[model samples]
Target: MSILPVSSIYLIIDLISGFFELLEYTFYRRAMITGFLASIVFGIVGTYVVIKRIVFISDGIAHASFGGIGLAFFLSHYLVFSFDPLAGAAVFALISAVGIGLMSKKKVQREDTAIGIIWVLGMALGALFFTLTPGYQTSMENVLFGNIYMISDVDIYLLSILVVFVLVAVFLFYHELQAVSFDEEFAEVAGVKTTFFYLFLLVIVALSIVFLLRFVGIILVIALFTMPASIASGLSHDIKKIMLYSWILSLIFVMGGLFLSYVFDFPSGPTITLFGGIIFIAYTLARWVRV
Candidate 1:
């Protein structure tokens, strides 16, 4: 690996100072914290997602969140009840995750076929609901591409709880999770509850998608979820080490991308995801050359 020169050291100092100044603002602070929590959850969940080769299922759930967003906004108009779009997304994500999880097991249909149908249905439902929504106009940009500035105190709290939940779940069930990830039939024959574990894993994935919504939006959450894990998988065969490396890689991408967006006035979600993709490509190239 190459090292930075003295000039680069000064640049790093200046950048850190600027980032600290930005953190003085409440929204900036929340964005950074939220990004940090998101990194942790995504890293842990993403390891199983990558190793299980269920990236498509994750993608479907993320995209399906749009339906929940639209449903929340539409219901808020006439239902005399308050609805949080994020909550709606959580609900829809769980439904989609479970639905797809079960459907993929059916011998009657191909998994991709089921995923594609649900994917399009979710998008269409969202569009219909958003179009019919009255009075206030929704910002498609914010819906499709997230703005870290939109993160709130409630989001912070929810994400904090989620990170803790994920940590505990993974720690307690690490062996079972590992068993299922590598081979479901072997795990089943060994008396593991394969079906329950499979659905439970998908539920965790749903929550991860919801937690990432404010930071990356539904459109780009999958990128942040999968890319870091992809890079980590290339680097480590041990699941625990892969999770740790993925967390570190995700943090670097989230923080560096946030800084880059702040400096260049780019959309934070896509900018962060783009940075992750670039880093993965670079890492892969370096590994190939070394080999």
Candidate 2:
């Protein structure tokens, strides 16, 4: 007589599972907010990054920051300080940025070659530093793959401030950034202070990379920086539209990946990256079909 009610109990269990799923999604929503803020900055800057053929430069900075991560671990272990690895990363990355910027001015060496040298040297330093430090191996995993659950309220506040700062700066210098991004020689002729802007952009990139390392880690951070913007750029013809789509797509990936990871018991950063790759491939295929 009660057999007919079994399906109702199953449905109730399903509903409870769905409710927990929704609750779990709140974490991912926070991740999406962080990713949204990050991708917008990256999208605008990454457009210029890709346009200037400085993709390798972004990779270089991302990798070079590993030195800072290792140093941060050493400091955290020995100095009994509570310094965020991200802070150390930003400091070192800014140094690398300045170094790269200065080297770019030298006519004897190409920017790519200079960046390549810095990249290798930076990683080597990081490896050496980590090996010299005690109690680094366990924590180093977080630096490489990231732990999205570590996104604290403080991090959210910091990321919010950075997003606002970058947006305002970009707005205030829209014409200048556009000019420099499109044609540095023309921008220089037009009194855009090309060198200043170049340096400024590098610093901004460094900051962005640092903030990203917490969620995506040093190894996969560049994928977050470049992939959404690349997908959006392929889909949009206008700069504004590209940025808009990039943020939206980034939001989708972060949220979707977070949800999937929670549901499937997978790592957050890799899930997000895998989601971004799928979106990029799907978008590319769609465009190819249309063409």
Candidate 3:
């Protein structure tokens, strides 16, 4: 007695048919391209995030971007200025990143406390803005849960530019970033301008979060950002190796999750995150057994 729904069986058949005739489906192609670009950015920046142990702050920035998205929607009708939610998320993410970075100083405030405040405040503001927007029906499901099928040619172009810029910038500054991630005091002692580099890293994180919003949404972006790198970190201590592994793992998770979503009609973002979590759990179990 199988409990599989008839739709599920039909989906499996459709998936097989679609595999060979991939070009027939524009949505699938767009998702693949977007996922690939997202994996690359996450691989590069997430390694640094894991090494620096600022995953919490990264999560904060991701959530805080919601405030920007809500604000964009609220202002678009009334304001003379053009309002792009993605741009709004970018601006809000950067502000949150900079705020977290500056407030992280021991003399100023507890970093975790600041992150908690930003995280909660961001959601609260978003709720308030949504409430105030007149006659605008809520469609925040896409922002909150993500729908990679919604990605457009413009998004692809923007992602392409962002990926190139991140790769080149990080490549040029690899050594400095490496020093700062492993040991900030030592980097400062070596005249690495730790504050400047730290700020630069946070800004990159902000950009990455904004770029990933459509692909994974704000709710699951943190998982995509951290899980692949986390798995990589478990396998290697070297930053380069970790990044490479993260990219490969992320590709697997995203591609497999997309296929599963297409077949079973599940949300792509959570499916992807779920796959990553499963892998992480297996790795952890393996390590524990080894010990």
Best by TM-score: 1
Model 2 Cα lDDT, one tens digit per residue, 1-291? 255688878866775577466666656556766776766766766666665666787778888988888887777778867667787788788998888987886556798888999898778878877898887785677777777766776777888888888889888987787787789999999788988988888888888888777787778777766777888787777777777777777778776776677667888889988988888888789889999
Alpha-carbon error at 204 in model 3, in Å? 0.5
Stretches of candidate 2 off by over 4 Å are 1-32, 80-82
Model 3: residues with Cα > 4 Å off, grouped in runs: 1-14, 19-23, 134-138
TM-score of each: 0.93, 0.87, 0.92
Backbone clash pairs for candidate 1 read none
TM-score (C-alpha) between model 1 and the true structure: 0.93
Please name the candidate that would achieve the greatest lDDT relative to the true structure. Answer: 1
RMSD of each: 3.4, 3.9, 3.1
Error of 3 at 50 (Å): 0.9
lDDT of 1 by residue, 101-125 (tens): 8887654669898888888888898
| Candidates arranged by TM-score, highest first | 1, 3, 2
Per-residue lDDT for 94 in model 2?
Answer: 93
- lDDT, candidates in the order shown: 0.87, 0.78, 0.86
Q: Rank the candidates by lDDT, best first.
A: 1, 3, 2
